[model samples]
Target: MNEKIKNFADSISPLIFLDFLFESRKNLTRLIIYFVISLGLIITVFFMQLSYSDSSRAGVINAFFIIICTSSALIGGTYSAASITSEKEKKTLTLLRMSGISGVQIIIGKIVSGFIYMLALSLPYLVLTLLLTLFGDFNFFRLAGGLFMWAGFTFFYLAAGVLISVLFKKNASANSFFYFSMFTLHFLISLLDEWFYRPLYDYSSYKFFTNLSPIDVWVNFSSSHLYGSTYYGNDGISSLFNGTVPDYAVITLLYILFSIILTLFAANIFEKYLRWRED
Candidate 1:
């Protein structure tokens, strides 16, 4: 068992370490700047939330959700989408392949490294927000649910970015497509939810469409947890679950399935591309 564990670690360590070292070497200065900016923004928001009256705790929570969701989508998506394209542009991808790393290893390494960087940028702000929630009479379970939802969304964004990066040869093109798709999806969902579903109080339609938006999923689930069924026209906790499974749980499962499918698709494309290059 120990030998098997050691072998497994050895197989992956080089890929992870090399990717991390390369990223740090290339973007150390930019990373430092981003960290400073993110820290400043988080501190400012924390203080601003503190200034709000106790009665406005819900507003504060909503603000935090907005910040987290926007940052995760933008920063995570950009980094992940650029990870492979940047390597190809630098002409180092062939060198790595020549070193005997499989295409799967390359994809996995990029995804892992991108996820680490994303978390580094996101976790501090999330922790600060969680701490603030403690003083705002928020339920711990609700906060946990929100965190889980955000984490799942972040993973989905990273996976989508990776798939996009593999599809587009140029970093700029991949990034443009990624941002455009993300914004369009979010905008359309919000418009539909507000302009169509909300006015009609169409519970079925609202639930179906809003679940497509990660932001809405988080908001609705968290609101159900915090305010119970009374908050959403009697469609709350009970409405969130179908039999035994919660609506958020169903959404999360779908996201995970989609991510897995995208990753597999990217890996197949990458492998074929590598083979074609060799020929």
Candidate 2:
């Protein structure tokens, strides 16, 4: 078991290390820009929190979750999409392949590298939020759960970006498609839920569709878990899983499952693309 674990780590470490080096070498300026933006946002939120009343601080904390989720999703998606598309643009993918790096390795490495990069980008916000919980009337469990949800959402977006990158040859095209699809899906599904589904369908259906948006999931989860609200409790969806699960739990599970499926699909697409190129 130890030997197998060691072998797996050995296989992945090189790709992860090399990808980070490549990103630092090629995208250092962009990374610095993002880091500066994140730092500015964190500082702004900190001052805002200082002025909020005790009751309003919860709302501020909730806003932190949304900000993190949105920024991480957007940044992570762009980087993940560019990671592959840039390689193809520079024709480095072919060299990597010739150097005996498998397509699966490249895909997994890109995903992991993007995830790590986003996590680093989010660390400041995460730390500030945690510090806020010390003085605010916040539920620790809810804060932890929301962070977990954000991480899952980030993975899902990054995987989708990878899939998009595989489908497009140019970084610009892949990036455009990723951002458009992400915003479109979130807004379109949300509008459908609010305008058509909730007014016409049952709570279960409304809840399912609403939870499809990671932002909505985080908001609803924070409301129910932290504020002791019945926003999701009255819904019959909870009973479907033996009444032990919350809506966010179900949503997190679905996001994770979809992330795995999308990553596999991207890997398959990449392998096929490589074969076509060889031919």
Candidate 3:
């Protein structure tokens, strides 16, 4: 038992160390750039639009920007997958493979690096959201809820992107595939909501659509002001968008489960064909 425990710890240590080293080497600069640019744009827009806005509408806009920042972090994982593919293209994957690093270690190390970098990139946005709470429109509970939802949903999307990268030979192809998958998901949901949900729920169309979109879970959850309001959009499964907060625990659990299952799935596929893939 002791030997098993030690072996497990030994196994994880190198991946964690590699993840940290890689993050320190490359991702710090990337995080700094993303944070500076995104925060600057958001702050500038908020101030520029402050004088023209009504308070209620301004709060909604703030929430929207917060969601955008959180959602954009999903791209970090996609970028990390491309970085792995680039290494594969350069034949460096062989070195890593030969170094006694298990396939699980490789995938998880890369995923952790990407996750850490994304959280760093998104810290500025979280701070900004906290600052908004001081204005009375945003509360602590709401802010926390939003962050939880955002991170959870981002995990799901990030896993999807990584899965695509594992399946594709080229980084460019992986990126295109991920984007196409995202677009198709949103489009199909929107179309189904518009064409089917609206006709069924009348005012309940919003809840159905939001439930379908794991991404919207946090955005809608923070929108206490939107509760009890009627959603007129054409979508199926009404009852969630009338400003009612869905079961956040269930949604969050679903997101976590989604990430784990997909990551395992990607790892399985990688282990099977990773050796045979041509650079």
Candidate 4:
């Protein structure tokens, strides 16, 4: 067992990690500059808007939450969607593949990069969270719940992005495919829940099956947020390890697990692609 673990670890390429780290570091500087500018803007807006404000805590929270979540989706989604395909476009992916690094290693590297990128983005942005406190009394759980759910969801999407990029040779094709497919699927899942899953939950273990869809996992928390979905009833890092496993946390874990499964599947396809290119 120990040998197997070590082998698995050894299979991962250090080069991918190094490249990802370098790319993340490059972005870090830009993010810091943006943070500084945004902070100034926020303070200016805050004082200027204060005179005209009649918003409650909940109202402000929801508005800010929507803005942050939307921005994260757009930026994170674009970055991830381009990650693998950009390498492919530059011919670097071909070199990496021919260099004897396994498909699994490549996918692992991309996922780790995504996670590291999330950290690189999120850590400095904590100051924004502090800035958010100015709007009203901040609900820690809401922030926690949003962050946890987004992290898991982002991981899933990042995997999907890499998979799409692996399947396509061009950056434009990969990005287009990722965006349209995810949007369509998100809608389809919402419809299914509305038409079938919601009424059947009391009588079936459908939530489990539904939760299997990352779309469903998202809807479970996001849909209910309109009515103040603040607690970590079954989600997030803190809720995952203490005592009973939260159902949502379980779903999040399933996402990570499925990500691995998807990565393996993508690797298989990637290896086949490499073989085809050689032939």
Q: List the candidates' TM-scores in order.
A: 0.77, 0.83, 0.70, 0.65
**Please, what are the lDDT tens digits per residue for candidate 4 over residues 1-279?**
999877766666476577666775778888779778866766665565445433343344345444444454556566667777787778786778766777677777777677666655555344454445445455666567556766776677777777887888788888888889777655555455456656654634333334445545554445344354423332233243663443455676777688678778887897787778778
Q: Which ten residues in a row have the lowest lDDT in candidate 1?
A: 229-238
lDDT of 1 by residue, 80-141 (tens): 89878888898887888887877777777677777776677677777776767886766675
lDDT for 114 in candidate 4 is 70
TM-score of 4: 0.65
Candidate 3: segments with Cα more than 4 A from true spot: 1-65, 68-74, 134-138, 193-210, 214-219, 225-249, 275-279
Cα lDDT of model 4 overall? 0.62
Cα deviation of 85 in candidate 4 (Å)?
Answer: 2.4
RMSD of 4: 6.2
**Which is better, 3 or 4, measured by TM-score?**
3
Model 3 RMSD, rounded to 1 decimal: 5.2
List, residue by residue over 147-192, the lDDT tens digit for candidate 3.
6666776676667777787777798888887777776665455566
Sort order, TM-score high to low: 2, 1, 3, 4
Better of 1 and 3 by lDDT: 1
Q: Is candidate 1 or candidate 4 better by lDDT?
A: 1
Model number with the top TM-score: 2
Q: Candidate 3: what lDDT? A: 0.62
> Which whole-number lDDT from 0 to 100 does residue 184 have in model 2?
79
